[model samples]
Each structure stands twice: as structure tokens, then as C-alpha cells.
Target: MGTWIIDAIATRHDRSGFSCGQPSLDEFLQTRVSQYQRRNLGQTFVAVPQGEDANNHRVIGYYTLAASAVAFQNLPLVRSRRLPKHPVPVVLLARLAVDRAHQRKGLGEGLLLDALQRTQAIATELGIYAVEVDAIDDSVAAFYTRYGFAPLLDQPRHLFLPIETIDRAIDAAS
Candidate 1:
């Protein structure tokens, strides 16, 4: 939380020291982020460390978002009842990771809120049924649940929160 800004990944930032305690996540951020960006497969945002200190300017955390869908049949039985009998539209929070050095300082939560806020703004004209994510593990799943996401009836590790419901909550909070 020291002078830092969460923004799109840029060429000038260093990503060599980001280790979120998860090897896969760390590897992805270090190696594959640029390829994904180049292919238009996903849009990744970085939590860029800022301030007067030159050494602190690095990508400490990041998350990727992409257009995706969930098959109607894959939804929880109780939750799918009102949806169309087809693939439900969604925005996938494909990956989320915060550097281990930066953990417990609210960076993960901040990145998530940023992603959701961006999604909320885009939902204005897009037909997003919900925001979805395939949880990396149970711990990650629990973290998202705390933000109002619920597991898919069929896939316990998968979760989502309806756009309408999120909007309502945001309106209420404001």
C-alpha cells in the first residue's frame, strides 16, 4: 500500500521478483503474460509498485480477464433455472496473483475490486451474465466467495456472481 498504482502491464516495469508463493502463478506472470497479451487471448493488468525508490518499481501483483462462457448445463441446478438453455455469457477472471512479498497487505483484494469495477462498467452495454473464475484452489475459491461469488452447482471450484446482483449490491452500498 505504500505509493503504488494498479494499471496495465507495461514494458518498462520489472517482473523478475514477483513470487506469490504459487509457482504456476509466478511463472505465468514472468513468462506468458506477454504472449497472452500479444495473441489477444486476454488482457492482464499489473499492480505496479511506484514511488521515488527505483528498486520498488516492479509488478507486484497482476490479474487477467477475458471473454468466456459457462455451459448452462454446468451451472448449479438451482442457479441455472432462469438462464437460457445455452452457454451463459461471462467475463473470466482467468488468473489472479499477488507477489508473496506483497501478500497480506490487501493487494489481492485491491486487484480484485479493480477488476470487478472494470467489469461493472463494461456490463453497461455487454450482456455479461456474471463474472466467472476457475479457482486455482480451495483457498482461492474461499477468497472469492467472500466477495459474493458462489460455486457452480456442477463444478465446486468454479464460481460466479451475477452482474445484476453485483450492481444491486453496489447501488445499495453507495
Candidate 2:
């Protein structure tokens, strides 16, 4: 229930104790995340208890982002109509998970908003058209739908939120 700070994953953050009720996700955080960052495959960020030092920072939640693309044909008709036929660039929300102990504390939503904000910033320098995610289950898909993500016409589990939509939301908030 303490305050949390989100930042890029650091080598010293204690990731070994993280368990999000998903073994694959746990393993990724504990083992593969640094490799992903080192290879430029993805950028992973972690949420840790506020005030923790370099040696004591314990990851409470984490998410990863990667540059990607989606075929125009895969987009929903409404979103695709005005776009070109070629693949559209995107930022993939490759993975998102919260530790079991911290599951109901709103960290997940905070992590999502953080990811969306980061995507919006990246779009200014890159040609990212949207933020995309492949939901691991129906419940997960519903979680995203509550936040304005729309499913791809050809793949219901594949959801996307257009950068333009995020831009408008950010502007309105401002």
C-alpha cells in the first residue's frame, strides 16, 4: 500500500522475487528482461516501492514495449479505411504483469497509463500509429477494452489503441 515509482528496469532491481500468477511472465522478469533490453528487442520498465535504494528496490510490477507493425488488413474496418494498404507501424505492449501481492492496488492501470504515455512520446519521433497488445485471455482483453482499446477485425485477442486517440485524450486532460 506504499507509494510506487516506475522507471526503466535496472540491473540491481530485485526481480527474482516477482510472481504475477503467470509463470512465463515471472520467468521473463527474473531472467530474460535484461537480455531483451541489451538486444534492443524490447524496453522493460518496473514499478518499485518509493524510497528504495539501488540494492533494495524490489519489482512490484513490470511491462515491456517493442517496436512493431501490423498489417493494414488486420486493423478494424473503421480504423483501416483512411490508412494505406501497407503495414502500419506500432509499439507493442509486449508484456504487463503485477506481483500477486500487489494485484488489486491499481498498479496495473498505472502501468498501462505509463505505457500509453511512453508510446505517445515515442510517436513524436517515430512513425508509430498505435499501441498494440496481444491479450493472454478473454479477461485480459476485457481489461484493455475498458481503456478504449479496439480489437483487430481478424484477431479478437489482438487489440490496439490509436496514437491519435491517445493524443486527443492527453490534450483534453491538459
Candidate 3:
């Protein structure tokens, strides 16, 4: 296992090698970065070697967190009824990708776990309701599901893990 130092990209200058390894992600960054700038909705957490030239950093994996909403109508029946009618403030785990070179190193899972931990902390501090993610594909959806995420409503690709769920998972793991 490789030692990774995880930290937020504090400035635009810190965004080196932040492009997604996946093509869809690349396009989103190219076309959407500017439009989404005002909201600062997109965030990147870079993982670097414990001790190396920071500029020579390779983004082994990254996941973006954003302020997002999911309509109550789009939530699962059990969750929907429990939520308010209007859109709720959600922390979106929008995209996550691991570099091809680091494919089997468990780095992807580490990034995800870090994302969840950070989001959960934010939710508690800011009173957000849920941590949501839009899975890029069925396989990605399955990965989140294995980690206790549930599909929102009938939308198989949109999933969420409530703060309680996250807490339970952490407790179980510990």
C-alpha cells in the first residue's frame, strides 16, 4: 500500500493534474469548470506521495464535492416521505477516479472513504441532510451500494448515504 497525503486544493494554482482520468470527467472539467466557478461547488482532494516534489504530484485519485440538491420526488419512497418537499442541501460526491497507474492499489477506496469522512463532518457542522452521488455507470453504482449507499427513488444511478448511515458504517468498521 502506498502512503498518501490527502488535502484540499486551496487555490486555483493547486489544481495541477486535477483532471479526471476518465473522458467524461475531462469533458466536464473543460466545459463546466468556468460555469461552476461562482458556486465553488467543485472541489478536488489530491493524494500525493508522502515526501516528494509537490509540483511533480500525480493525482493518483480524486473526488469532487459540491453543494447540490435532489428533489424529494426523486428520493426513495422511504426517504422521500421523510424529507421536505423542497430541494434539500446535499453534499454531492459528483465524480471519483483513480489514475490508471494506481488502479489496483486501493487508492480509489481510500479517496472515497476520505470523501465520506469529510462530507460527514461538513454535514454535522453545517446541518446538511445527505451526501449524494451520481454514479457514472452501473458498475460505479454497485461500488457505492457495497459501501451502504442506496439509490434515490427509482433513479438507479443517483445514490445517497445519509449521515446516520455514514456514522453506522464508521462505527461498524471501527
Candidate 4:
């Protein structure tokens, strides 16, 4: 496998060739990421081959992070009991996808780790309680569950991993 450098997406990064076998995700990278960024809705990060030149880098995987809130009632009782009754702030992992050619090569895990690491750093200065994700299906939900995410009480496919858990994971990885 080749080395990859994950960073904020730029106009210089080439994304037209990315295909993750998920049409909506593929189309988002190709079309909507910039708009979301411009509107302050989210920021998309991309993983490209490490040695590629500035203008020649091809995005092989990507993830988007956005500021979001979740209703206190949606959280599981165990996680929400100590918090206030209002909505809780969170980092929304809006999208995560690896190119079809790059699937099964551990790139998906890499992207997820990168997102969590970024979330941890941001949480140090922000009021983020957790990182949440809306899995497209049960299989994807399972993937997040394996990494310690807990599903929302009312929506199983909407999962979250607390900042505390992310801290533990990062410390262990280090």
C-alpha cells in the first residue's frame, strides 16, 4: 500500500475520479463539498497519495465535519442523564467514503481515525460533547459500533462516540 496524506480539501486536489460504490457520497465529493464549505455548513477533508504534486493529487478518500446538535431526548439514558435537557453540541461526521479502488485497504479506518483525531483537537477548545454519525445502513452502523459508538435510542443508525471515548482511543493509539 502507498503512503497517504490526509488534509483539508483544496481546489488543487483532484476529486473527479473518486468512486466509493456509494453514488450519493461520490457525488457529494464531486459536486457539493465546496458549497458546504462556503456556507459554513461543513469542511471536507481528503486523503491523497503522499508523494503527489500539489496540482496532481487525486483524492482517494474523504470525510466531512460539521457543527451540529442533537436533542437530549434522542440520546441513550446512560449518556444523557448528566447533561441538561436542551440539545447538546456535537461534531457531525456528515460523510465518510473511500474510493472503490481503495476499499479494503484500511483506508476507511484511517479516514475515521483522522476524523476522530480532528474532533478531539477541536473539542479541546469547543463545547463538543461527542462525534455523531448518520450511517447509511446497518452495515455501516456496525462498522461504527465496532469502534465504540453507541446508537441513538430512537434511531439505531444514528450513532455517536463521546469525546471521552475518543480521548481514550487516541491515548491508546499513541
Among these predictions, the greatest TM-score belongs to: 4
* Model 4 worst lDDT run, 10 consecutive residues: 1-10
Q: Per-residue error at 78 for model 3, in Å?
A: 1.7
TM-score of 1: 0.91
Overall lDDT per candidate, in order of appearance: 0.86, 0.92, 0.74, 0.93
| Regions of model 4 farther than 4 Å from truth | none
* Runs in model 3 lying further than 4 Å from the true structure: 10-21, 27-39
Q: Which stretches of candidate 2 lie over 4 Å from their true place?
A: none
Q: Write the per-residue lDDT of candidate 3 for residues 9-108, one digit (tens) a residue.
A: 4333233454545787755544554455457768767676577675565555667788888787887777767666988778998878766666668888
Please give each candidate's TM-score: 0.91, 0.96, 0.83, 0.97
Task: List where candidate 1 sits over 4 angstroms from the true fold.
Answer: 1-3, 52-56
Worst 10 residues of 1 by lDDT: 48-57
Could you tell me the lDDT of residue 14 within candidate 4?
97
TM-score of 2: 0.96
lDDT of 1 by residue, 13-90 (tens): 688988898899989888999999999999999888667355546888899999999889888877788777999999
Please provide, for model 4 over 120-140, each residue's C-alpha lDDT reduced to its tens digit, 9 standing for 90 to 100: 999999999999999999989
